[model samples]
Target chain A: MSITVRIPTVLRSATGGAATISATGSTIGEILAQLASDHPGVQPQLFNEDGTLHKFLNVYVNDDDVRYLGGLQAPVADGDEVTLLPAVAGGFA
Target chain B: MLTLTSEQRDAMVAHCIRNLPNEGCGLLVGSDDGVISQVVPSANVADSARVYEIEPKVLLRTFRAADDSGEVVAGCFHSHTHSDAYPSPTDIAQAPDPSWHYVLVSLRVTPPVLRSYRIVDGDVTEETVTIR
Candidate 1:
């Protein structure tokens, strides 16, 4: 299955400034692995040494969060769009 | 420069003020050029005086409204209850769209201060806020 991954601004450097990229994978985990292989610079930002998605990174398949859709094991199909967003917190000092 | 109408600016300020000790957050809707046409006051689901989380239901509704109105989600707006109108490190790290404007309102001073910024690759650059 072909999936399009929307790259967030913070991780764009890894993709050579590309806003989106397409890769082949049957599941979200496979797609991410292929993406990391294609752009090694993003591996550290997307996953930890334990090979799991970083705590602050939130992945969404279309409009549904992957965490609610079986996470890495979530099945992916052709023309699926995945977005990565970082969890942000800021307010009063 | 980011352009905002006086009424929209005032409404945003009022929303922040109404939130009191808690930080207020909302979405800025407009076209791709940073001309904000609407201020979508969203609920701060974080419920903490020091943090703000946009309510998901409200967010969905806001996006739908923007779509129905032929506007794009251009930026984010939030208030700092007791801090400067600047983006914190967390904000920088979480900035998802390089093309988006980050509008901040600070209620720390007698008159609330408002600022706009573009955060790209961990860099924060302040932009001019043109009130029309």
Candidate 2:
């Protein structure tokens, strides 16, 4: 299945400034893997050494957060749009 | 520099004040020139006075709207309940977009202080915030 991944501003450098890119996969993990493979710099940003989704990153397939859709195991279909956004978080402490 | 209308600035302060005790957060929608057209208040999903997280749904919706409007999610703002208007260590560590203006509102003072910064690769640089 072909999917479109929307690249956030911070990750644009890794994608050669492309705002959106196309990849093929049936699940979120596969799509991300293909993304990292195409853009090696994105690998470390998207996954941890243990291959878990980075805690600070949010992945959405369409409007649904993948975390609520079984995380990396979330299934996707052709023409699905996957968006990666850095969790906007911070504190005084 | 980050430029915002005075009313936009007040809206951010008001949202932070409304979420008192817990930190407030929001997204900034604007052009590439740093002129903010909208200040979108969001729920601090973290719900902690010391920290904040922009609700995911808000983020998604803001991004979609910006995409459709030809504007961009230029940056974001959050409140510092007890500290000064500066990027905290947590803010630096989690600074997502280097091109984004990281705005902070310090409610510790009367008439809450608002400031903006550019955090890149963990380095924080204070920027001028123009509220007209």
- Chain A vs. true chain A, TM-score per candidate? 0.91, 0.96
lDDT of 1 at A6: 80
Kindly list the per-residue Cα lDDT of model 1 for residues B11-99, writing each as its tens digit.
88999999987888888889889999888898787787787776655555565577688887788888888889999876776676788
- The stretch of ten residues in a row with the least summed lDDT in candidate 2 chain B is B88-97
Best by lDDT: 2
Kindly list the per-residue Cα lDDT of model 2 for residues B1-132, writing each as its tens digit.
999999999999999999999999999999998999999999999989998999999999999999999999999999998889989888998888888999999999998999999998899999998877
Candidate 2 Cα misplacement greater than 4 A, ranges:
none
What TM-score, to 2 decimals, does candidate 1 have? 0.75
Question: How far out, in Å, is residue A87 in model 1?
Answer: 4.0
* Per-prediction TM-score: 0.75, 0.96
CA deviation > 4 Å runs, candidate 1? A9-13, A16-19, B31-33, B55-73, B92-99, B120-125
What C-alpha lDDT, on a 0 to 100 scale, does residue A68 get in candidate 1? 77
A7-92 in candidate 2: lDDT tens per residue?
99889999999999999989999999999999999999999999999999989999999999999999999999999998999886
Model 2 chain A scores worst on lDDT over the 10 consecutive residues at: A84-93
lDDT value for model 2: 0.93
**DockQ agreement of candidate 2 with the native complex:** 0.83
